[model samples]
Target: MGISVTNISKSYKNAKALQDISFEVKPNELFGIIGPDGAGKTTLFRILTTLLFPDQGTATVAGFDVVKDYKKIRNSVGYMPGKFSLYHDLTVEENLNFFATIFGTTIEENYNLIKDIYIQIEPFKDRRAGKLSGGMKQKLALSCALIHKPKVLFLDEPTTGVDPVSRKEFWEMLKRLQQKGITILVSTPYMDEAALCDRVALIQDGKILQIDTPEAIVKHYPTSLYNVRSTNMYQLITSLKTYEHHHSVYPFGEFVHYTDTRSDFNPEDLKVYLESKTLSDIQIERTEATIEDSFMELST
Candidate 1:
C-alpha cells in the first residue's frame, strides 16, 4: 500500500470535518475523494500532509506516520492545495525553483519528472504567478509540486474554477503522472471526474458514504431509474414530486432523474398519465445509473 488511512477524524470547533474515515490506496493507484464543498476533503488532505493535526486516528503516507514522521512525510509527498498557494508576486520560474530548493533539491535534479508539464508553461516562465491565466497557473503549481519527485501526491480540488478545456488537459497530465508510478489522492466536486480514477470514495457531510470502483458504485444503485423532460419543466418536476409511486425525483440538466416504488413500471402508462395532466412534449426514457446518481442515493 502507498497510503493507509485508519479511523481518521478531524473537526473545526463545533463542526465535524471528518468522521472516522478509513481507506487504503494501493501503489500507483489514482484514488479520488469525491464530494462537494465543505465535505472535509481539504481537512483530510491537510492532515495527511502533516499540515494540521487530526483530532483522532492516524494516517500514513510513503510509510511515514503523519504525526511522528512529519519531516519524512514532507520530503516524500507533494501537495497542491485547493487554492493557488504559490507566491503570487513571484515569476513562474521563481516559484518552481523555490519549492525545489526547499526540498534540498534543484529543478535540474528532477526536471525530467515535470518536463512534460513545464514545457506548456515555460513560455510564461518570467510572468508573475498571479498574472498567468488560470490554466497556466494550474500548470505551474503542478510543476512545482512534482519538482521534488515525491512518492505520493495530494491534490485538493485541483480543477475547481478552471475552464473545461483546462480541466481536461489537467486530468490528462495526471494520467501521465500515474503512468510514471506516482500514487495520487485527488478530491473533486465534479462527479464526471470520478470515473477517471482507479477507485473513488464518495463523501458527504464528513462521512464516507461508499468506496469502490466508479463502475461498481453506479451498478450498486438499487432501483431502476428513468430520465424525463417536458416543455413545462417546472410543472413536470412539481408533478413528479407529488406522484404517489415515485421514490425520488431530482432535476438533472435538461432532464429529471426519477425512480419509483413500483416493480412493474411501464413508461407507456406514465406518458398517458402525464398527457392527461396537460403536459406537452413530455419525453421519458430508461437510463443507466451514473456516478452522480449513485452519490445522490448514498448521500440521501
Candidate 2:
C-alpha cells in the first residue's frame, strides 16, 4: 500500500550518510522525517524514491522492490527535492508540460491531479521558472511532480526558504492531496512541522531516535522540567552547576530549563537557595515539553 524500508544504509567517501535506517509508511498517511541538515533525511528520501539505492538494505514502494523495480518505483512515486530542480529557462507551463510529457502524459490528462496547486501560479504560466518567487517555484515544482498522478509523494524539505504564509499554504495543499488517497512522505528540519504529520521519525547523525505521533513523542519526556530565570543569568547558570543534584540545565529562551539534581530535591529548597544568593527577579515555573526539548533530551 505504501513504502517499507528495511535496514537501509549508505556512505559517501568514508562518511556514513545513513546507518541502518528503517521505517514504514502507511497508505494515505502523511509521514514526516524530522531532522536538522546533514542528518541523512535527504539521503534516505532519495533512496526510497529510487533516485539512489541503499548500500545495505531493501525497500519497496507500492510493493515494488526499490533496486530491482527502480523504473516501476519511479513511475509510482512523485519526488520534490530540497533544491529547486525545475528548468530555469523554461516557463512554468513549459516545465509542467515537460514533466508530463516525460511521463507519457499531458497536463490536461492529469489536470485534476494538480489543478488546485497549479491554478495558483497559472496566471504566471508564461513566466520563466527562474523569475518566479520562491513559493511560486515550489508550487510549480510540486505540480510537475504530480502531473503523472503518482500514488505516493516524497517531498524533501519542500517548504524550506519559503515565507511563513506560503509554508502554511503548502502544508494545506498536502492535506488536500492526502484526501485524494495520495500517501505523503515529507522531510523537514523545522521542529514545528513535525506536529503536522500523522506520524514522524526524528533522525540525527544518520540514526533514527524515535518514531511516533508528535503528541506521543512529547508526552514521553520523563524528567520534570522547570523554567528558571534570574537577573544574573550567567551567575545563575554557574551556581546551579555546583549543586550536587543537578540533572540537566540548559538555556531555554529567557530562562534556563532545569531538572532536579536528585529526584527527591524540593523546589522550595531550590528557590530558597537562589534567594539567599541575591539573584534578582528569580522565577521558576513548570513548562510544557516541545519537540525541540525532547530532541535535546535524547541527543544529550
Candidate 3:
C-alpha cells in the first residue's frame, strides 16, 4: 500500500554511495528525505523509482518490487528528479500533453488530478519551458508528473532553485495533494523544510542519522542549547569556540548558538565573560531544540 526499503546499498567503482539504508513511507503521508549534497539522496530515490538497481537488498513502491515489477512500479509512481528533466524546447502545454499521451491517458482523463497545478501554468501554455521563470518551470514539471495520476510521487529537491515565495507556495501545493491520498517522498537539503514533513530521515555520508516526526526528532536532542548574541557577530563565534567552557558554537541566523561543556551551565556566567572580553550588547538566553539542532547533534 506504500513504500518499503530494506538494507539497500549502492556503489560506484571504489566509492560507496549508499550503505544499509532503509525506511518506510506510509500511504498518503508526506515523507521527507533530509540531507546535504553528496549524501546519496538521489541514489536512493533512483533505486526506489526503479531507474537504478541496488547492489544489495530490495525495495518496493506501491506494493511492487523494485527489481521484478519495475515496469509496473514505473507506471504506478511519478518521479520529478532534482534537475528539470522536461524538454526546454517544448511549450508548457505541449509538455503536459506529451506526458499524458505517453501514459495512454489524455489530459482530460486526469484533468482533476493535476487541475490545481495545471491552471497555474495554463496562462503560459504557449511559452517554452526553458523561457519560463524558475517557479513557473517547477509548476509545469509537477503538472506533467501528475498527468498520469500516479499512486506515489517522488520529488527530489523540488524547491532547490526557486525563490522563497515559490518555495512556500510549492509546499502548500504538496499539502493539498496529500489530502487527496497521494503518498509523497520528497528530498530537501534545507533543514527548515524538514519540519514540513509527516516524517523525515536525516541522512549524511550515505547513512541515516535518525528517522521520526520533526517534533519527535527535536525532542530527542540530548543537550541544552542557548543563543548568544553580541554587537560583533563574527568575533563572537571565534571567541566562543576558544572559550574553555563552550562545548559547541556555530552561527545560526543573526545569533550564534552555543552549548556548555560543563553540567553546571549558567547563562549569567557566559554573559559576564563576554562583557569582560569587551563584547557590548551581549545577550544570552536558553533556546528550545530545533530539527537543525537535533540534526547537527546526530550528524556529528
- Pairs clashing within candidate 1: none
Candidate 3, residues 117-199, lDDT tens digits: the string is 88988988999999999999899999988999999999999999899999999999999999988999999999999999999
Instruction: Encode model 1's per-residue lDDT on 1-300: one tens digit a residue.
Output: 399999998988999999999999999999999999988899999999999999999899989999999999999999999899999999999999899999989999998889999999998899999999988989999999999999999999999999999999999999999999999999999999999999999999899999999999998899999999999999898888877888888999899999988999988887887888889999999999999999998876
Which clashing pairs does model 2 show?
A: 245-261, 246-261
Ranking by lDDT: 1, 3, 2
Q: Worst 10-residue stretch by lDDT in candidate 3?
A: 291-300
Superposed model 2: Cα runs more than 4 Å off = 232-243, 272-278
Task: Report the number of backbone clashes for model 2.
Answer: 2
Best by TM-score: 1
Query: How far off is residue 23 in model 2, in Å?
Result: 1.2
Which residue runs does candidate 3 get wrong by more than 4 Å? none
**RMSD list, candidates in order:** 1.1, 1.9, 1.2
